[model samples]
Target: MAQKDGSTGSRERVLAAAAAMLAEDATAKLSVRAVAARAGVSTGSLRFHFPNQRALQDAVLARIYGHLFPDEQIHDRSLPARDRLVNCLRQALAPTGTGQQARETWTKAYRTYIASAPTEDVRAAYRAMDQAGRRRIEYWLTVLADEGALPKEDQASRVRFLSAVLDGLSIERALPTDESILRSETETLYTAVDCVLGGA
Candidate 1:
C-alpha cells in the first residue's frame, strides 16, 4: 500500500513538473531526463508512470485542457451549439493578446517553429500541441453532434476547417490591423461556425 501511494505521488509530481516546464516555455522538450530532473525523480520513475514522451505530453495537455475548458460551457445546452463552439474557440485565442502582446507572441512563434528548421524534439512538441488542439475541437464538435445540433459526418474536415480559420485569425491578431479587426474576427468565427454546423 505504501509503495502504491508513493508511486502515485511520484506520478503527480512528474506531471506537475512537466506542466511547469511547458508553462515556462511552450516549446520546451519534455525529454524523460529533463522532466525527471525537474521533478527531482529518477528517470526510471518517470518512465514507469508515463512510458514515453508522447504519453507525458498527452497527459499534460489533457490536464491543461481540463483546467482551461472544464466542459461546463461546452455542455451547456441552453446556449446554441454554434455559440458554445465559437466561445470555446475564442477561449483558445484569448491567450494571444491584441496589439503589442500579440505581435510578440507571433514573433516568438515564428522564431521557434517557422523561421528555421526545428530539431526533432521541437517538431514533436509542435505536433503534440497541434494534435491536442485538434482533439479539443473534435471533442466539442462531437458533443454538439451527439446533441443533434451538428451533423455527424465529415467531422475531420469540419475540425480542420475550423482550425484553419482559427490559425488565420490568430495571425491577424498579430498584424498591424485596424480597431475593427476584433469585430471582424468575431464575425468570421460566426461564419465559420455556421458553415460547419450547417454542413456548407
Candidate 2:
C-alpha cells in the first residue's frame, strides 16, 4: 500500500510540474528530462507515469481543458447560438491583452519561437499547442452543429477560417492601436461568427 501511495504521489508531482511549465510558457517543451528535473523526480519515474512525450502532453492538455472550461458557456441554450459561439471564441482570445502588455507578450513570443531557427523540440512544442487550440475550436463547432444551430458545413474549413481571424486579431492587439480597436475587434469577431454560421 505504501509503494502504491508513493507511486501515485510521484505521478501527481510530475503532472503538476509539467502543467506549471506550460502555464509559464504555452510553447514550453515537455521533454521527459526537463519535466523530471522540474518535478524533482527521476526520468524513470516520469516515464513510469507517462510512457512518452505525446502521452504526457495529452494528459496535461486534458487536465488544463478540465480546469479551463469547468463551466463552459458554449452550452448555454438561453443565449443565441451565435452569441454563445462568439463568446467562446472571445475566451480563446482573452489572453492577448491590449496596448503595452500585449506588445510585451508578443515580444516574448517572437524571441522565444521566431527569433531564429527553432530546434525540433521547439517546433514540436509549438505544433502541440497549436493543435490543441484547433481541437478546442473544432469542439465548439461540433457542439453547435449537434444542436442544429449551425449549418452542416465542413467543420475543418470553418475551424481554419475562425482560427485565422482570431490569430490576426491577437496580432492586432499587440500593435499600436486606438481605443476604438476594441470595438473593431468585437465587430470583426461578429463578422467571422456570421460567416461561419452562414449569416444566420
Candidate 3:
C-alpha cells in the first residue's frame, strides 16, 4: 500500500506540473517530452502513469477543472446566509484564487481546448467541466436553502439569475478597466448577490 501511495503521489505531481505548465504559458504546445521535463520525471515514468500523451492531456484537463469548477461542498454555516452566499459565489467564479495574469493564462488554455485542433475527447473533457460548473452552483444554492438562510423559493431561477450576474461581471473584468472600477466589482458582486437572494 505504501508503494502504491508513492506512485499515486508521483502521478499526481506529474499532472500538477502539466497543469501549471498549461496555466503558465498557454501558447506552448504540450509535448510528452516537454511535460516530462517540466514534471522532472523520466518519459518512461510519465508514460507508466499515463498510458499515452492524450491520456496525460486528459488528466491535465481534469486537474484544471478541479481548480476551475469544483464539485466539493463548502460548509461555512458559521457565517450569515448572505455571507455564505457571497463566499460561495466568489469561490465558484475563481476557485484557483488566480489573479489577473493567471486568469488570463487559464482563459487562453480553455480557448485552446475548444479550438478546432484537438480531438473530440479533449473537447468533450471541456464540455464536461461546463456541466460541472452549473451543478456546483445548484449544489451551493440547495445547501443555503436547507440551512434556512435562503427562502425555499425557486432555486432554479436564483441559480440562473445569479450565474448570469456573475458571468457578466466576469466578462466585464476581461476588458481593460481602472483600478477603482475593478475593486468595486467585488462589492458590486456582493450587492447583486444579496439583492437576488432577497436578503438585501
Q: Which ten residues in a row have the lowest lDDT in candidate 3?
A: 94-103
lDDT of 2: 0.82
Residue-level lDDT tens digits of model 3 in 148-171: 767656766776777777666665
Model 3: how far residue 169 lies from native, Å: 2.6
Q: What is the lDDT for 159 in model 2?
A: 85
Model 1, residue pairs in steric clash:
none
Q: Which regions of candidate 3 deviate over 4 angstroms?
A: 1-74, 95-103, 106-110, 113-123
State the weakest 10-residue window (summed lDDT) of model 1.
57-66
Question: How close is each model in CA RMSD to the real structure?
Answer: 7.0, 7.7, 11.8
lDDT of 1 by residue, 63-129 (tens): 7766876764777888988899889889878888888898999899898888868888779778777
**TM-scores, one per candidate:** 0.66, 0.66, 0.50
Q: CA shift at 118, candidate 3, in angstroms? A: 11
Point out where model 2 deviates above 4 Å.
1-68
